[model samples]
Target: MKINSFLLILLFILMSSVTSSSQAKEKAKHVIFIGLDGWGAYSVPKADMPVVKQMMADGCYTLKKRTALPSSSAINWASMFMGAGPELHGYTQWGSRTPELPSRVVNEHGIFPTIFQLLRDARPEAEIGCLYEWDGIKYLVDTLALNHHALSPDYTEKPEVLCRMAESYIKEKKPTLLAVCFDNPDHVGHGAGHDTPAYYAKLKELDTYIGRIVSAVEEAGMLKQTIFIITSDHGGINKGHGGITMQEMETPFIIFGKNIKSGGEFSESMMQYDVASTIASIFGLKQPQVWIGRPMKQVFK
Candidate 1:
């Protein structure tokens, strides 16, 4: 009788462990990260972005999310994907195709470890895709880790075409991770100025593209299993960024769909590097010790 009771107790402990593991598993099967270049948080109030505004109303969002210092494109983009700041990842300049300084730790790929490489390592068969309007973005991600990647031949002029390509990719591949980067807003910001009418107008146009992408996800039948993360690298001033001003520092971070908390305005501080860690959390992958970013698990259900 004593041996039987001990066996039953062991069975109960095993069952409990299994249940706990099941409960702790991640809910999202796909994460679509949308990055808008030069999109500043300060412009949210006056800008006419109905689709993104609806996402903010229905999802977790914070307008106070900050970018890494210098607030330039390549530096912050590197931070957003590499899960560390310039001082650590070593991509410090505005259009850094390669690390300006030696990386603290580089993966076998010779570049600093990025979220894409982490996901690829954890899930070998997972589909990872990236479509970017700016050619510079290609240099930031691990192309060897991605299953599909494209650069817009039109450069930053047309975002709608990029959205169409994304739509097709979503329906066909049903990617585990997809990053769609639009550069038109930043292009307009540099040309006509950041706070000008053209910038807001470009945002409104981009909102339609965003809506279209969301619809495409639904059409591909991944909405219930997918999460949408909309964010930006930096905001700009009159016609430029890479400064200390709030407009150049603060950007919006929005997370929606698939077991995420609704209408959550996270007061907890978020930074650019946190985006990569959050993506890692969605995949149930452990972050490297070198990564300083923390997952916003507060937004998860």
Candidate 2:
């Protein structure tokens, strides 16, 4: 009787462990961060971005104002991914003159470890990938030793190409984190103001690309397990960023997908760094100590 009771107890313990492990796996969350290089909050309503508009309506959005120092792409993107200010990241502008080199040089090295690096270390089992037009993010990914795939510098891609790449990564690697940066609207807006017909057309093109990604996720059957976050680095000035104007500083923040409460907007003041922190929280990882921004917990519902 004693031997039989001991065997039954062992079996019960093994079953309990298996059940707990399966439950933990079921609760795992995946994140896809979509970056619109130069989108601004003020332009979102007017811009004909149907998919993004629908996401805003169906999920949580924040008119949460943004301010970027040196508002340049290199600086803002570094700040956003590193979750630290320029002072910490040491990426003040697009170009940093190194006294060691006689000629002017661009500073490609960011000072702090990026959120990607932290995630890679904390969650090695999680697959990760990044598609970005800027070299700054690539530098961060390389420095952090994170797993990622970058887009070409020319920012040229057929809809099919982008879709195929994303689909293959999700299907083959099953990455828990995916980051994509689209630069069309930003480039067009810089050449032409947001009100221009060209800018509106670019917005529509961006929406179509976004729709493709959404469809791909749905088809992959990962839609319910994924969290989609769409945001921008900084807005543009009259035709460019790196300025103090509201048009150049304020941007949009939208979140959709599993576990997210629908239909709400946050008008409170927020910064770009919030993106990294929020993503960290979604993965059940502790925010990096160097991260300065607070996680916008209200958006998670």
Candidate 3:
């Protein structure tokens, strides 16, 4: 345990030093990570996703990004949140139950601290918010303590409400971080078939909400200082996942912000853990020593 803490401290110091020297220009004040659950890589064609296309055109993106193994929500999301694979985070099952963590580890006594836990620990006064349609993510060990959070059975009908709340929070509290998850596409994909019209329609509908919220951010004049990181936990089969098929493994990763470089190569491979690392990089947070992935520097200015 002593070794773990020492390593983390050393890593934090080194990363902070680099960040201060190399990444000090145009540091972001807010970061919004939008996870479109089960969003397939091929499903985001320009014809169907105008808003997404606009965002991609304004940022760098990869439609070939791969998620973690097993393709399960609990596993992939856990990996994304804690920047650890299933072997480290110990959450390989489904359902809304707290994760089983190691008996001992670093970071405020939490074995594998989620970004939410780390942010709250580091900055208690800084506001943070999250809205998720997948309830399973609500139970990650120390995730229950975020400044603002909301979960629904699914994102079918009432997701707009979550968006409204997120917009309100952005305008009212100006949270340091606001994460939102849309689960309706995955829900409809499972029942109707990932390639079916219903699934595509659901994604399009969700895209409209995305445009609305982003417009809210723009209207609030936060976009110039805010970073937008978008991706998915995993893709799905016609309506199911948890398999290793290409459809179930591939997802799209996008990064857009004033400081981020635009129209860059989108061919670099990325993993689910890189999502959190990239966000950490944007906010100048020291990438945790336990996280194996690094920021996609190709996306930064």
Q: Which 10-residue window in model 3 sums to the lowest lDDT?
A: 96-105
Candidate 1 lDDT by residue in tens digits, 1-301: 9999999999999999999886577669999999999999999999999999998888899999999988999999999999999999999889999998899999998989999999999889999999998888988898999999998777554557899999999999999999999986788889999999999999999999899999999999999999999999999999999999999999999999998889668899999999999999988889999999999989888
Worst 10 residues of 1 by lDDT: 151-160
What is candidate 2's lDDT per residue for 197-245, written digit by digit as tens?
8777777887887888888787778888888888887777567777887
110: Cα error in model 3, Å: 3.7
lDDT of 1: 0.92
| lDDT (Cα, 0-100) at 190 in candidate 3 | 78
Clashes within 3 Å, all models in order:
0, 0, 2
Q: Give one digit per residue, the lDDT tens place, for model 3 in 238-300.
A: 779889898889888887886878874477778887777777777667766777766787787
Off by over 4 Å in 2: 1-28, 95-111, 153-160
Pairs in clash, predicted candidate 2: none
For model 1 the local lDDT of residue 125 reads 99
lDDT of each: 0.92, 0.71, 0.76
Best by TM-score: 1
Better of 1 and 3 by TM-score: 1
